[model samples]
Target: MFTLSSEDNTNFTELLKAVHKIGSKTIAKHAQDVDQKARFPVESFAAIKSLNLMSAYVPVKLGGMGLNVEQISKICEVLALYCGSTAMIYSMHKIQVACIVHHCMQVDYFKNYVKKLVSEQRLIASATTEIGTGGDLLSSFCAVKESDGQFTLTKKAPVISYGEAADDLMLTARRNIDAPNSDQVGILLTKEQFQLEPISGWDTLGFRGTCSSGFIVTASASIAQVNPVPFSEILSQTMHPFAHITWASLWSGICTDAIDNARKFVKNSVRRNPDMPPISSIRLAEVTGSLNNMRNNISASIKEYTEMLIIGDSDAFTNFGFSTRINNLKISSSQMLIDIVGKAMMICGISSYRNDSELSLCRHIRDAYGASLMVNNDRILMHNATLVVMHKEAR
Candidate 1:
């Protein structure tokens, strides 16, 4: 589905196999507890870190495996099947890495930081949301107050996913004290560079292991710590596409697991009756069709996006058509996951509702619902509508 040379395919397959092994042996075991406790998935993430998969998004020349988005994506999908929380945390981490790799290469400071990440297998978190911005991630209420080649920032972040677990975060703020609220910059900070006093809880319906708590973030770094590119540019060129696709891939994994369970239940029922396929088989086929549609939609977007990236389409990031398409893929994937998982729940009946049932989908059903609300689908739709009104056709 994703284009890769023959040798690349072979290596990708082996890497995926290794990730699946960790998922099955480690992540799957801790999945339920992680959900039940609403705490960090220490065991699962530890195993992944041990495998040195944390740096897969870093270039091989910089000490990583040099895998592209598709390879990291497949690995994310595999992890999701075992534990949604682990998968989400992993996906967000890679998104931060993608932004850095794509936009920060020209800066020696960030270049060295990338190599440091690969060497230490460091975990990176994101701090994009602000309390005063009302969830307007593009606007910042704080700015880098600089002095003598040094800078300090005091940001009230409304949500910092996996903040306690990560060693570093790419924090977004205004470019300078005099800059407009919409003028943004990203800075790299480690534990030493920042003080995070967690001020929120993480209890939620799905992806609980992410541990997304609010924090009063205070940090300072050298002037060199700032990436020269604007935050909006980085979002349009790298962060947006990487985040949506990787997140969709993980959601697809949740859908795949639910469908497989439904298949098992329906097949077993038919075997027991031995008269004909159960009436539920119809619904099974219907949901399976939706699942296939969802997967293909995601895959095609990845392929098209990758092609544009490879061809160096200068306007690819800002093209209204491409942006609308990306938004649609996110909307479709989010909606389909809920539809597919809901049908799977109905097919299995009482058993699937029980936590002890082998076909239990309570976790999956809960996790699937996170899709639409995570980034607020209505916000995305409204943004696309405005773009549609202004987009000129290629006449």
Candidate 2:
């Protein structure tokens, strides 16, 4: 499904096998507790960090695995089957790595930082969504202030997924005080360089393990910490596609687990009464079909996006049609997860609803809801609507 050298393909296969082992042995054991406590999946991440998977997306030349987005998406899918929060945190970290690898690594400072990240197995967090921005990612309320080759940025973000646990933060802000809010630059700041003031708690409906709370972030860094490429280019070329694809992959994993549980419930019922098939057997079939459709949608997008990235189609990435298509993929995928989970719940009946039942889907359903609200599906639709009105047909 993806192009890779023989050695990399072998390595990718081995890495995937390792992730599956970790998911079942470590992540699955802690999933329920993580959800109940609304805390970070420390044990699952300890297992992940032990394997140094944090740098899985980085290039082999940079002393890392050099896995592509598709490969990484598969890893997220695997992790999510055991624990959605662990999968989400892993995917978000890789998204930041993708942005830097694609856009900022050309600069010596970021290049060295990538190597450092690989060596240290450092976790990176994102701070793109800010307060008073109405969840608008392109604009920033904070600006980077520079002085004598040093710079400081103060940003109040509504949520920084797993921020407290991260070793570094990949943040976005206005280029300077005089620049427009949309003229933003991406910056990398280590824990030593930034101070975080917790403004809100992380008690949420789903994705509780993410620890995504509001924070007032004040960061100081060398001017060299800023990426040379503009945030808009980075957003279009790497961040948008990487984030949507990985996120969709993880959601599919969560839904797949729920379906599996529902299937198990049906099988158990059939064993008890061989005379007639359980009514939910039909629902299991229906949801399975929907699951396939959801997976195929995600696979097709991964293939298309991977091909464009391989060929370095920067213009295509930024095009209105491409952006709309990616945004729609997110919207559809998010809705499909909710639909799949709801159906699975219906199939398992009270068993799925009861938190004590082994076939329970309460956790999966809650996590599925996070899909639509994370970025808000309506916001994407409205943005695409504007793009559609402005997009011109190619002759």
Best candidate according to lDDT: 2
Query: Across residues 41-95, which tens digit of lDDT does each residue of candidate 2 receive?
Result: 9999899988889998877878888787788999999999999999999999999
Q: Where does candidate 2 stray beyond 4 Å?
A: 1-7, 390-395
Task: Tell me each candidate's TM-score.
Answer: 0.96, 0.96
- In terms of lDDT, the poorest run of 10 residues in model 2 is 1-10
* Per-residue lDDT over 63-136 for candidate 1, one digit per residue giving the tens place of the 0 to 100 score: 77778777778888889999999999999999998888878888899899988888788899999999978777
C-alpha RMSD values across all candidates: 2.6, 2.3
- The Cα local distance difference test for each model comes to 0.86, 0.90
Q: Tell how far residue 186 is off in model 2, in angstroms.
A: 0.5
Provide the lDDT at 77 for model 2.
Answer: 94
Candidate 2 pairs with clashing backbones: none
What is the model-wide C-alpha lDDT for candidate 1? 0.86
